[model samples]
Target chain A: MRDTIARCETTAHAEGLAAGLTQALAAARDGFSPPGRVAALPADRVPPGAAAVRNRLAEREGIGCFVWPGREAERPHHVRPGHETERPHHDGASDDTTTEFAVLLGAVRLGATRRLLEHAVTHLSGRTVGGEPTLRKQLVLGTVADVMTGVEAARHALLTGASVPDAVADTHERLTELDWETTKLLGASGYLADGPARTAHVSRLLADCWVAAPGGTP
Target chain B: MTELDAPLRELRGMCREAARDLRTRALAVDADPADVERHLDSPTLTLIRVASTPKRFRADGSVDDGGYSGSCLARVIAGVELARGDAGLICANTGPSLAGVAVDALGSEAQQEAFYDAIADGRTWTFFGMTEPDRGSDATAMETRLEAAPDPADGMLLTGAKRYVGNASRGRIGVVFARTGRTALSVRGAVVRIPAAGYEATPLDMIGLRGARICAIDLNGVRVPREDVLGAHLPASRRGLWGIGRTFNVMRTQIASMALGVALAARDLVREERPGWSGHERVSARLDAALALLHDAAVQVDHDPDARRPPSVAKLHITDLAVRTTRWAAHALGPGAMLEHPLLEKWCRDVAAFEFMDGTSNIQRLHITHDVATRATAPRPSAGRVTTPTADRVTAPQGAA
Candidate 1:
């Protein structure tokens, strides 16, 4: 009786694996843009067009593909991917996905910067310092430059697609530094507004960007 | 200041005095900042004491034709004045006045008379309970259920829990909204005496607005008589959650006025703390813009009671400004601002509540955006007819002030 039950369980497992593989292969073949569609391959049996497939998965799954490394003694189990992974897939995110996230982060930063700048202009206009638009102009220009640099970095990284370039990595660091400078320039107002008062609205942008970056994403 | 008419000038004078007295009382209170009695006794309640009387309620359940004193504009001025003293105090008193406004808007002649008669002494507190435990900005999606009793003449049985009910525990009268059926659109409203059997109200501890006894109410088969069900004969669209749109046309402006007052208070505090603070062009400009936004909305509301967009825009802008201004003020006073001046932090926390209290800021923007889109897509008037923009078309002043 126990042997029969074990046989039935093994059969069910094999059937389920077959069904999942069939669905995943079909998704990969048709380029599944919707979530929850992922295909797995043995580490030793990686396909020839692995890079292209990884990029496609990153674009569709947002966080990128999974590549589970097999243990020395144990055979790998075929686990299916859901709409969202429990953790960042066991493997790293593609450079393309990182670049995409950087662009999104850049947009959020720019939006927040513009909101504060507009506020500054309105507030300063009525003060004694109202005579000079120089400081405000300079800050605005600096922010615009930061946005442009971020966009350029993202475009380059996306075009490259595979390994993260040194410039792209540096650009992400620079953006984080720029965020610090922004908070300082706006002074305590920016710090409080982004931290406690507005529920970390400005800080959340940076945090989200970090989540999509190299070390954090995987 | 612009030239004011005689009646408006008089009304403003009364409000100014009330505001001055209220501020004086608030400032006199000792280090125990959470003193609810001080807030209750604060002259901010002068607006409520004077405005909640039977004389203010006409025979037909409408406001008396007593010039600006009987108009929403008067309440707007009073709200601004009360808020200047303390936003918490304004929040506490605002609930009672809102209840009065709801009664005037939807109550029958006897209902209004009963409410006014009960509150004639000026100490009686009234409240409105629409938001439930599960509902926030989308209060229309309430879970509080109302069912018909066995006898059609016996009224409905209400069973549900309401959260964030301002003044619920302390107040005698309440305007409560409950879902009548399983459908999303089946929400209805009824007025009831809260201390009645099966009705339980527990005061909630809050981060700010301490003066306001925000409560959680559990209505376990609370009976709501047929006559007390607001707009019962009216269709679903004209009553309960749906009908609040009409009520908000007036209430939004009052809320804007309160927010404006808080912003003004924050501005004054910052300017006083750092004498050189106003020298910053950014600070000055921001204050001016905020004031301009408030004035624009006030003008629109004063001209036409039914004007929608201006009040919402004002409410949205002023609430944001109030929060921003308070935070800015605290930071301007150096690192120990929170410790040195507790009022700044208190005001900041209190003003933050306004964003979610009336309706979330996102909800306000959504309504405004939808209204703008709807108007834009609406067919233009017949050819050869010239139509003026809403801002330009000035009708007879509302509130008869």
Candidate 2:
């Protein structure tokens, strides 16, 4: 789980890692009972008392994410990344199906990109931070990074002709790298470092990513 | 003498005398008839003397040193006089009077004396005609025009309309901004005093602050003398947008102070009338917070009148707080407060006007974001307050102002 989380390149991958870690922590707090132990017991063998105990343990671990020291071994399990991760594939698939997945991925990425640019206009028009102005700016900048990554992954999937699910999965993997770059820039500058220079940067990057995909057509 | 010390001292002495005279008159309203008569007779002239003395004496006074320039002192004196007499209309009439002070600060020495002398002697009420009907936040985008030729008789033909000019209706002089060259972006301002016949002002009936007579001044080929061109001596490349940005800082601070006065007035009234109200505890807490905020803002404003971002933030916070605090006061006071009680409703109205005065909160925030996005680091708190070093502490970014 730690290795998988460490390898996460996109927001979707990071999110999947986070969800898996959450489940593992939950099971560990339930006293490491065998999977079928409770089923083998009498109807009420694993009493509500055990369930409450497990609930408290989970709560404690959740709280630890914020309060635990950096040196603590358990800290990493609870520390959620600021950026979202890409979605993972549920089944193995051949390469030929990947191209079909790219279309769906492209639509979603394009929609997000459009929304982000629209938000920048509203945000820049106003002077205040917390109001409609700040919200718009944040949305625009935040989604630009996310959409750029998704487009890159979609292009790779389209070229490879993987199954729809495999294509999405591959796209998600490519997105993780872009997401890291975006977060780094955001942390360095209080605003999006590149998007402000020009409105077309996001679109151009996405277009290039699509054209570079294995498929002959964008 | 430091550039401003001598003049500041002289101005302080004048203002002290003026304040004392006003206090004396205020206290003697129901006292001895002779005392009241004497107080009434001398108050106007005495206050005017006090206000104008800052300009005349040009010596540093501790209380009012920042605003006391040769002509600014004169306008402050005029404002103090107008304020003391409770003449809202005359006080409102003083917007253009104050604009002359700004002209003195940014304009040339000749321009300064011309506008200042007129304002000081009560010969002219000059409007700083910058804000246009279509261009509220965008002063540089003003559509007004001033075509210049080589003729000394008609130095420049000013043909543009200035809206919401305070003293426009009765102004003897106008410090107007117009597109002097071909470029709409090439806007330049001049101090032009024309015969009343040359320019016409249509009075604008505003909702509140009825005392200030705001008008729309229309200029049709109103000729301006070459000497009247403010900052004309400076190269356009040098003057640039920095002049307007600098002037906005001063204007915003003054406006904030006015709003602060209104807030103080509202808070005082609520405290006096609602000694045992239900939400007195909550109101007290809010008032305490509001006062703290106001004090922080005022200190920053006084320390550095030119720090654009802090004051913009201060103005937005203070005015919004003023409006909210006044509303709370009105609600807590109930029906009695709502009635023709001079304190409650009048203050609410005054503060409301302030909220929209300089630029709306939206406009202020937009400026703040633009500054912040472009700014490498937050500005130091007006170069006065000591900021302790931290790891993430980036040095203050130097802005245009």
Give the per-residue lDDT of model 1 (tens digit) for A1-218.
Answer: 22322232233224322222222232232221111122223223334443322321112212222222222222111122223444233222334443433333333333333343444444333322224442354544465456446544543443353235333334444444444334333322332322321322322222222223333211
Which 10-residue window of candidate 2 chain B scores lowest in summed lDDT?
B27-36
Write candidate 2's Cα lDDT for B44-119 as tens digits: 4334433433354322232343344433222333333233232233333322345654574467777666665665
List the DockQ of the predictions in order. Answer: 0.02, 0.01
Interface RMSD, candidate 2?
27.1
Q: Model 1: per-residue lDDT, tens digit, B247-299?
A: 66677777777776776676677666555534335765775676556556666
Superposed model 2: Cα runs more than 4 Å off: A1-218, B1-54, B57-90, B93-96, B149-152, B182-185, B235-240, B275-306, B375-401
User: What 10-residue stretch in candidate 1 chain A is worst by lDDT?
Assistant: A29-38
TM-score of each: 0.58, 0.50
lDDT of 2 by residue, A57-151 (tens): 11221211111112122211112221324211211122222233233333333333333433444444543343344335554455554656555
iRMS of candidate 1, Å? 21.4
Q: Which portions of model 1 miss their true places by more than 4 Å?
A: A1-218, B1-3, B24-43, B52-54, B57-68, B181-186, B232-237, B280-285, B302-305, B375-401
